[model samples]
Target: MGYFKDILKYEKKYRRFTVLNIVFNILYAFFNVLSVLAFIPVLNILFGAEKRVIDKPEYNNISDLGNYLEGSFNYFISQKIISEGEIKALSLICIISLSLFFFKNFFRYLASYVITFLRTGIVKDLRDNLYHKIVELPISYFSEKRKGDIIARMTSDVQEVEVSILTSIETLVREPLTVIISIGIMLFMSVKLTLFVFILLPVSGFIISSISKKLKAKSIKAQKETGTFLSFIEETLTGLRIIKGFNAENVIEKKFNNSTLSFKQLMTSVFHRQTLASPMSEFLGSATIITILWFGGTEVLNNTSTLEAGKFMGYIVLFYTVLNPIKLITTTFYNIQKGEASAERIMSVLNTKNEIKDLPNANAKEGFNDKIEFKNISFKYKKEYVLKDFSLTINKGETVALVGQSGSGKSTLANLITRFYDVNKGEVLIDGQNIKSITKKSLRGLMGIVSQDSILFNDTVENNIKLGSQNASHDAIKEASEIANAAEFIEDLPEKYLTNIGDSGNTLSGGQKQRLSIARAVLKNPPIMILDEATSALDTESEQLVQVALEKMMQNRTSLVIAHRLSTIQKANLIVVMKKGEIVEQGKHEELLAKKGEYFKLVTMQSLS
Candidate 1:
């Protein structure tokens, strides 16, 4: 129920629709009771036990109002039969019953119709908020989370919340109202029989509650298994080449089968308990009906109760009507219990506080001016520091290349400069101001990054090049592509700039993808460029071409080049060689070679290998 309260926050946006549903459900419940009660007159006409009265009854108190109305209705029907005969009386009862039935279904349909807005609206808002959070959270947040689990939370888990929670909105409101109205009428018909029903209902409710007590826990387990298999599928698809090369299909299939087996077992328990709700409730309701018939019939025979035979029969029919609502309410309760697990999973993500957020008064840095400085910054992704007491300075419009073995803190500097992750100690400053004080959007806006992977979506060549500068003109995209040496091949494509690259630009070669990524950065035309191993994954011919494009893009731009290949950084203004998260040597390529230090060893090693 607490989770239900949290979910209602999304409902505030669609309050008008919610109110309409409530109003219609109320009408439906009211008419549901009236339709059953309307059958009493027809029962009397058929039984041939109609009572006639010459005078109209007087209303004295509210307590006897039920009996007074019952007698008055019987008297009017008796006179109708005496004056106009059974034909007119029968037609009149038929008309009243038909009207009640029509409105009962009409209001029921209206309730369902109004609830559609809430059901779909809440799911949409939930998905929107989840996606916003996924994008806004820092990259470190995803380092420990499985991508498939997040996808499951966003897709199937949300759908479960809809099926098990939001879809039951009508039953949650209407069924209880139906039960209350039916109970009230039962009490009016015979207090003793109604009292007997009250005695048995709590016991029945306790049994249903007990069965569903473990449903939420089981449901959570099933959903987690769903995520596990989905993650396996995502991983398998992404690495299909590796899997097939290794001949690991059977291993992967067996692991997936185990996960599905666990999910199937858990869901079996959850659904079995859920399925028991209806039959158990119906059985209890039938038992209550049989008891009421025996007691009410005994009272009528011994003359201890004032209920007429026709009214008692109608009372029994009305009580039977109450059973379906009770069963539906019980079923809805079980569904909510299961849905609470999904709601908790969703709210966990929504309620998480992002550790990285812009300050209320943070300054927006539109452009770089002076030097970019790392002032004794110590940082770590975990327990051990990746960069400890590291300090460097690069002036405006300078190219500084960082060369190191993997895990030597070269890439960490690029991340720090871009504010992807903040320093645990000291500061990363742009133009003598701490980068933390700058709004992240504005800070990253001044720089263009080309990573090793050359990530590209499935879109046109023009659209991929103009990703950052979406409003750039056709001539600008063409110029950027030419600058990256991609225009020659792109122009040879089927549609050139209008060509649709397949998934992740798989239709293009590695060199083409990397060039497209470079073209994107060139189109943005930012002052600062961070090329993190931009050409480390290419062949000799592709590397040479990409190197030419990289040099052209780096003209007069403040660039931080992280590279493994020593040939690429030979002409950099300053080359820093790093070992074990600390700088080992810093000088020109010729100067470092003359010293025969760490940079010299790297060059010699690459030359040997």
Candidate 2:
């Protein structure tokens, strides 16, 4: 009814394993009863009380039942003592009994072994789907969610699903089965005594259910707090340098203290509810057994019941055997309730609709032909539309530079071109086809993107640069590196192409990383490229080096360049000056400067004395 089924939807892939596990578990339960019955025979012989038969046992009704047993015992001992083999027959029965006991355990182990595959397979698929969903979601999703919370769902929350739910599946199937089988055996022995057991079950079930109700609430809070603290931890790692730089260690520490305190409160509640399961079940079980002995003993001692002394003790032991499974089942219910929270969290990610999925019947965008058009396109992150009635066009193989101050929709234009957030109104088209109508992979395949952040994985220099084109040969990678002017410094490194860049390529300088980004774009050799303030964060020399490399990559491709530095794009084919999401000026650098308009003012403001 909830995320349990949603999370277990992954288990459908292991249907064969599930069927086999159920079969083995059924066999295990059957033998669990037989193993207990094996003791009945041993006790029968020891107490000189094995059921016997008198005369020829008839094939009739309950009136003939005593005669059947009386006849059975007479024939057995008469043949045994005559041949002096009664003890040998007894030993043979014991051996068979032991074998049944061993087979039961063997099948039980098989059930556990088969279910291992299903549990681990579900976990692996859940994690894989979570990661896939994370990437496909709009960037705005990450903007609102904490990084630590996402990481917690992937790690700790998933582990909870494994430990609390996946691990309990066997108990879900096996424990109830053991309870049912034990109750059946107890009934066959004496239904009056068995019905007494039935009355106790509903009471035990009620108390366990009550404890489990509180578990889900506390477990949900615990998981939420785990996410909150994990977010704080992730933030601290990324901003450690900033925290120290500003001497704000105490402020950050206080924030962390608050998160952990909240987490501790929630977990305390969860564990408290979990602790109730064992003792409550144990008490109920003891009470049920004591009641059985008091009532059953009266009938046995008064000769009102046929149950013998050893047989009566064995039935009590058999009922006791169910006590542990019943207690375990109680604990399992609490665990499932706790794990239900994690399954909901995991399913939330898995169920999240990707905002950037491909259009139905979408096809790969071939190489660019006609000019790219941004025709009356409008968009926003949320609420207010930032780009209203916006339109522009970039010719083939021309660099169109977008320039403006912050919050003026300069970067929005860059993002829209990459389809990071699809336009809320109108359309962006390549050639004549709407960008939305083409698969994102195919559409993006034609363009090389270099963002202001220079996103790079923690990997080798060669791998980072080759990310845009993984099939590029080493010589081609070197050629691309040389073109971006990154080859000289790369050669000086200890491992050259094989050096690890650490997280986000932090081992490389801003300029060096930017050059590497350009090198990556160069290797891709796309028909169009988007460069968002590529050299804006660099010092003078670093800016010049990165700029020259970027210019080299831009030589033959259609480019959309967003620049804060006016000097870098003075030679751009056309400069589009924007203000508050509207184009105020669009023409060559000289023409916009000659007009003494918005573009001219921006340049005048940034000019050297």
Candidate 3:
């Protein structure tokens, strides 16, 4: 119920709907009881249960309460004197009974109608909140999570929470009220019989509850399995080309099938456990009914009760109504049990602590000044360090290149400088202030990055380049493209800047996309730039074009370049060579070449014919 309470809190926004629903439901319950009593007066008129008194009728005990009610109704009939010959009292009682039935149904419909807004409203609000949480969560959280699993929670899991749980609002209120009203009437019929119900209810509740004890734990596993399989499907679709290339379709399919088989088993278990609720509760209610019949029949036979045969039959029927509600109440418990899994999954995301929120009193840096300093910084994704005791300083308007092997933590350095991830052990200062003390927005705004992959979008070329600088003019965009050497091919395209690049710029060649990425950075023209082997993936002619664009971009900025090819950093004012995580060499490109150390070894390997 703690999970259910979390879901309920969303209804606070629609509290007016809640109040209105309550009002109509109360009216419905009152009329339902009144409707059942209406039948009593009609029965009294027909069966002559109404006492024809020597003097005016007077009140009796509550069981005699129904008797007094019938007598008073009879007096009203006799006083009216509007006799239509076919038993005026019976016709009058019939009219009231029919009217009570009409209003009983009317109020019931109104209650349901009012709750429609509340249920859908809560569903909408819950989904919106979850979406916001997903967007706000840091990218690191997604590293170990499946994309498909997240999608499933957003779509299928949320929908299940809505249909299975939100739709229970009617049952959540009306069923309990129905039982309360029915039990009240039954008590007035005989408190002695009602006491038997009290005993019967608890035992049945205990039995039904025991069946659902482990239901929540199983349900949580089922939902997790759903996420796992969805992740598998998502991974399969994403890498379908590679899978087909390697002829590993059967391998993936078998794994997918295994995941699906497990999901099926879990769901079957959940259903069977849930299905036990109604039957077990129903059987228990039936036993209670049989017990009442035995005890009540004996009283009537011994002349110790005044309940007539028809009224007794009607009371038994009303008690049968209580059976369904008891069953439904038990079913809701199981449903809540199942919903616990969804609630836990959804809450996990919603309740995640944001690791990258701005500090209070954080001030925005006005612009880049002094030097960008990496002072004895270190970091790790897990336990051991990936970049240990790494340090470098790019003086304002200088070009610095980082040359290293594949896993030598070049990319990790880029991530740290960009503050995509924070360093663990030391400070990354900019213009003599700690990067952590500055607002992230202002710090990131001062820099531009062009990664190895040359990330693009399935949008117009203009939109992609003008991303951060949304209001950049066409002329400015054209100049940036020209400077990046992308203008020639861009203009050759049918729509030029307006042309769609397709997904991740897949429509264009590698070098063309890289040039456009450089163009985007040029347009931003931030004081600082980081190029992660940007031109390495290009063909010979395209590589030359992009290398020229890079020289132009780094002309007067504090630039940090990571190069795999060694030759690209020949003109760098300072060349820093790294092995693993530590910088093994540093100085002017000529000075590093003269060292004949790791830097020279890399150059010799790459410079050969």
Best by TM-score: 1
Compare candidates 2 and 3 on lDDT and give the better one.
2
Any idea what lDDT model 1 has? 0.89
lDDT (Cα, tens digit) per residue for candidate 1, span 3-75: 8778878899999988998899889999888888867765665566654655778888998897788778877
TM-score per candidate: 0.97, 0.93, 0.90
Mark the regions of model 3 whose C-alpha exceeds 4 Å error after superposition: 47-82, 85-102, 306-310, 473-479, 487-500
- What overall lDDT, based on C-alpha atoms, would model 3 receive against the true structure? 0.83
Instruction: Name the lDDT value of residue 500 in candidate 3.
Output: 95
Stretches of candidate 2 exceeding 4 Å from the true structure: 49-97, 301-310
RMSD for each model, in Å, please? 1.7, 2.7, 3.2
Worst 10 residues of 3 by lDDT: 77-86
Question: Which residue pairs come into collision in candidate 1?
Answer: none
